[model samples]
Target: MALAGALLTGALAGCGDGPVRMGAAAVVGDDRISTAKLDQAVLDCQRQFKNDQVANQVRAALESQRQQQPMSGEPADCSPRSALDTMVNFEVAEAAAKTAGVSVTEGQVDQMIGLMGRQAPAESIVVALGMPKEYTRDVARMNAAQSLILQKLGADGNQQSPASLQARQQALSLFRQAAGKLDIRINPRFGSFDENRMTVSPVTTRLSATESGVR
Candidate 1:
């Protein structure tokens, strides 16, 4: 139900107007995901992960899962860069949904959250995924849109089924096409956009070893 694995794919081609706005993390079509929004999402993640004990517990659980399945690449950390990645993903998914004539309303999001509550604390799930509580509705809507898109592509939501796999591929293709049409751009301060992965990579910096570094 999460948008985590759904939005990652190769970059698409599109154009933007004028220059990117100052303090904007990324521009999706005419809309911008501002730095302030990115900061808030990162703060929410920090607040949730601040307790060392709980953070370790969650990290350990995730590590165990990774060991069993061996994910293709390193997992993203709960940092501002990753928050920006998530923001862009949702924007792209929304664009794709619009193109596919899929709509997810607030009531539908609430219903989905209620359904998910049967398995785990919905708030915990949202926070653990580095999404702000205030943005829970948006997250739910994004998930619903993704589900609808897959359904339209003939997926039954059984992720392991061949039909589901084919649907996922088609859905990703649609997202990529939508993203290209939208002409999304990211600020270099956060990272460069990896069209191959459809996510931001942390910028590399050369720190002077002799200079006083913050601990």
Candidate 2:
């Protein structure tokens, strides 16, 4: 979710050209992220969200202390389409990595998750983002790839620096160019996919936003 550039969550955009292929939530190059897979991830987030809700209700009954579950209230946002967006985003990040000549190993991904675990249980880290606990490795790979992409491009990670800002724009441009060449498409049920912005617009706003013109 922290990829470089402006990822628009504001306006709705029209769906891309051509069909998204049956049962596939998205198609990133030859990789098919299936609807069943998206459903599983969404269901996982909902389960966690529901657990948080129930925990809150139980704690409300307590006369004294608050619940101390570290992973309880993640993903402050859980729209049904959100998971699909993330799944697609992860794939896009991987594609971008290949073009950037950056490669991530299993150990690197494990280390990434290990670092995240210091904050919260690795399994509990991404429920709020709608990623299934089983896909934690995928999320880590995305994070690793994004970090390496910026580093390779000489983009400073510090947000306040002008050089970093310019590097971020450059990174974004690289992602957009990579996306333009892939066979990427999103299922209408999940709204429209904007490759340049790497966002999925919901069905309600698909017709109002301008097309990203990505193939």
Candidate 3:
């Protein structure tokens, strides 16, 4: 699905540290984005290169240095663990919306797509979270789900009422449950997390080849 960062894609924003080797270290929830998985994905990008070259290229390309302003109490990276973290958050939120039987219309999706186009004139606006063109529909669904949750929460008046709190608690519990099921391990070469540190806002931006029409 179109994750938050995906939505913020192309906005010049930015992930992790571990072993000085190839692959995904751990999976956030049930999803395992292991080193081999990460390597294969990278290799897919530059098929002309050998496996060693592909691994090195990915190492060079992935975010290595911390750039974002540290949040008051957050880590430099969001540090969710694996790609599954995004999906876990999305699914939890989506499940909440589904429980309420919320529905969205095609017209609304079109409007959002239109708004993104207006917000980004130079960059193409095909999806909500900067996902691939093929995922536009999914992005619209995610946006709608977000809107539904916000609307209900706002209508509740107590905002932090028992039900609202329970919903949030349930979501977190599900995420933690999935995470516990995985065979996850963090490689020290990548970087260690500082539980006390926070990432600052106004994250650093990276130039996109798309803006330059390179590829």
Clashes per model (N, Cα, C within 3 A)? 1, 1, 20
| Local distance difference test, each candidate | 0.71, 0.69, 0.39
lDDT of 3 by residue, 1-215 (tens): 33444434431111222232234443332444455543443343233222234334333333342223332222211122322233333444455565656666788666655654563421123211222234455555656665565555443435578776765555445433433343233333223222112111233334356544468
TM-score of 2: 0.73
Best by lDDT: 1
Model 1 spans > 4 angstroms off:
1-19, 51-59, 72-76, 204-215
**Residue pairs in clash, model 2:** 75-128
Model 1, 17-58: lDDT tens digits are 344578888888888899998898888777776654444455
- For model 2, residues 21-64, the per-residue Cα lDDT tens digits are 78887777778889887777777777775675433343243313
After best superposition, candidate 3 residue 68: deviation in angstroms?
A: 6.1
**Which run of 10 residues does model 2 get worst, by summed lDDT?**
2-11
> Could you report the Cα RMSD, in angstroms, for every candidate shown?
9.5, 10.3, 16.2
Where model 3 places Cα greater than 4 Å from the true spot, the runs are 1-69, 72-90, 121-130, 155-215
Superposed Cα deviation of residue 18, candidate 3 (Å): 25
Q: What's the distance in Å from true for residue 79, model 1?
A: 0.5
